[model samples]
Target: MQFTLDDEPRFPRGKRSGIGIIGCGHIVQTAHLPAYEKYGLNIVGVYDISEQAMRTVQQRFHVRHAFASVDDLFASSDIEVVDIATHPAERAGLILKALQAGKHVLSQKPFALDMHTAQELIQEAERRHLTLAVNQNGRWAPPWRITTQLVQQGAIGEVLAVTHLFDTRFEWVTGTVFDTIPHWAIYDYGLHWIDSIHCWLADTPLTSIRAREYRTPDQPMESKADWGMWCEFVYANGAHAMIRSVGCSQTQRDGHPFWLHGTQGIIRGSILGKGNDFVELERDGISSRYPLKGQWFPDGFAGTMGELLCAIEEDREPYHSARHTLRSLQMTLAACQSAEHNGEVVPYEEMKR
Candidate 1:
């Protein structure tokens, strides 16, 4: 099914908004490209360091222009929005460059490799008065959206705790041992869970985080062993949350499981493998099951993108603003740091200051 904002009156009416994409990697092919196509936006150009990858996307999407350098893509006058899907380590510099060029940016999560850099990038965007957004798309998953609504309506009264578990069994025989695999799990998959948790508990800004990380014995640092991580997040209103992720599960299926418990009710959901998606909400001892629906963009990407377009056209902050993205990023990065330092609880104030 295609994704279009035409049905939403809040979205702008023009199909002429041009979008340029940097990095024609896996996500670009599987998610970003499809999203742009579904939205009916003008994809004016694409750029990647790898010539073969660039050619592959250009041919597959029938995009008219392809550039070997990001510089060239940013220099294009026709490209109004820039999507940066490059590695996390390179995100800050690329985003700054894009913003400096007077273009709106939609970047992959973990907006920066670290909080300091993320702050700098955010400040730059604010200074330039440009739209800067991160792809925390998991919030748009139908199940999560329903959960958000239920919680907001007090179906889940005064959320007390949230437990999120993401477990994926990577078939070692078939998995690629890329050089950046060590930073893969947390930066790649963990961001989705973290972002989703924040969305579910909107008023909570993680106050303190304590975490632990584990890695397999046989894996190289680059392709580190299946790692598992657990983190505790404390909220300002005395709410608490626990997030756990395991990169290598002996279990045959990949499951990103979530259980949210509150004073009045509970919501349980799982995104497992390709077809095993389900959401169960329990309120007042009456349980109802809702089949999950996956959208064209990950979870929150499409809605956030549509909101962003409206914000840009109408001169307002998008629903998922840079400030929100930064808070999520700060919490995740602090978890990583806390884990590395032997599970010491890191305070949110420390990350900000």
Candidate 2:
């Protein structure tokens, strides 16, 4: 059988409004600006604590204005949306300010450092009647996106289990600011996987989660973040999911395989960003491969902003809204808490506590 799926990123078709970026960090320089430029989105201005950083991005992207402070950016009537790409420590405050200024917001991943703070931000956005979306761009990654669409479309009847493994070197964090994050492996780098698991099984009742973080003797790390971790999710309906990461590998193996087992069929694929990424399905003893387009880097970035804009235009909740991501944040935070307790199971109800 031949199949077609809406797997590509989409931009808002009506009244593409001005977006002001709050941080001009590496991600903005590399992914956000480039993707926005490519998709023809209007960036009215940008601001960063460092003037040099702000000027560099402003000159590079030819932005209309580079604000001297975030207050100025918030005051500008040209901007209706704010992209808060600041680190988690300072992100919540900026989000609140943006919402109070009557602007929609698109937050970076790992939405907030804690559940209470994330919830507060979500509620504040709701009170202000503005769009607040998290940048869980992995949901738009080609392979994972297709998998979710297939499951939602009932191509795979009743998801039973999801298994994902990542075996790759993570030398980038060494001697960098990223290594300083607590549970950096799971929270900072592995957050996309956790968010993806939550997205696919959102309707299912999650019972508890167990996770562990480990360090290997051969691992090269100068910080507290271990290079390895594994997390398991238990569901009330007997369906479950597992996500594992091996960040110390000298070489990536098997494209970081993943399998989704459902009652009717099995969908298997490797995560994106690795070379030779692919997805396949099996049913009635027949196997078929689905050809995918686009990579995660810039496309996923575009998808997040696009969905937010679309939601704003249509007056509906974006698929990656902050309210929806609260559950994702709970699971990830619980994983970190569970790791501290030596892989003890943490119940979903107790996540807030």
Candidate 3:
């Protein structure tokens, strides 16, 4: 059988939504707007707490309307969806506001810091019959999307384990808004890896998680970096996953490599920005490599929003639905709890308590 998969990002085939952006920060300018424009999605308008920020994005992107406040944007009947790109702390209220205004929402990742807040937002969207999706864009990253499709197709049959290892310089967060986040590693950045694991193993129930974060002794104090993090997830189906992120590498050979092992075969690939990014499948004593085409930057962003748009047009739940994302959030919050107690294992159900 020839192995083929639909790994590309998809948009609505019928009706494209008009989206109003609520936060015009770095990500909006760099990834969100760029991807939306690339896919020809309608830009209804933009609003931000900072007028200057909204004005800058509006002028640069040539967006027609710049709302002076969140209410002003919500009042626009043209917007069918609102993209809440604000920090996690302020996102929940904005999401509620949007839902009450009868607009579907695309939320930034690590949906909420606590389980209660995440659950409430999903419930409100459900109550309003509106779509609420998370921008867990890493799922649509080329390597991850292909590998997930292969797994779903049973090309790698009954996955026994998955591992993600990444080593990179940490300077990007050093002086930025990201550095101030609590549990900065898992809450802010590691959510992508956590959510990817959930996507690949959606059927298996997660039992428990153990995680740890460390500051490298060699890392300079001035850098104020959380040098490394490690997490392990246990599943009810006797499968497991391990992830380690090394965020303070000074060496030139930075890479993000992942592996998935199953009863029948193994799948492995390096993530984007590495010199080589591709997926390889080995089964029945044969190995084949598939080269990937797109980068994670804008394509992943497109995938998240596109799924939401299609779901609305087709009258179905989005693959990136906020309800489905709660599982990933459970594991992420569990990892933080585990790390706080000196890497003690925490039950996935414990998060609900």
**Candidate 1: tens digits of C-alpha lDDT, residues 186-224:** 556577777777777777666788888776553446554
State in Å the error of residue 41, model 1. Answer: 2.4
Ranking by lDDT: 2, 3, 1
Candidate 3 lDDT for residue 229: 87
Q: Counting only residues 3 or more apart in sequence or on different chains, how many pairs clash (N, Cα, C under 3 Å) in candidate 2? A: 0
Off-target runs (Cα >4 Å) in candidate 1 are 1-11, 171-183, 216-226, 296-301
Whole-model lDDT values for every prediction? 0.74, 0.87, 0.87
Please report, as a residue range, the 10-residue window in candidate 1 with the lowest summed lDDT.
1-10
Pairs of residues clashing in candidate 2: none
Better-scoring candidate (lDDT), 1 or 3? 3
The true-versus-predicted C-alpha distance at residue 330 of model 3, in Å, is: 0.3
lDDT tens readout by residue for model 2, 1-353: 44557668887777898999999999999999998998899999999999999999999999989998999999999999999999998998999999999999999987688888888898999998999999998888888888888888877789999998886776667788887888987788878888888987889999999999998677664656687899999999999999888777676453567899999899988765457677888987998888787777788899899999999998999999999888888999899999999999999888876
Shift of residue 312 alpha carbon in model 1, Å: 1.3
Winner on TM-score (1 vs 3): 3
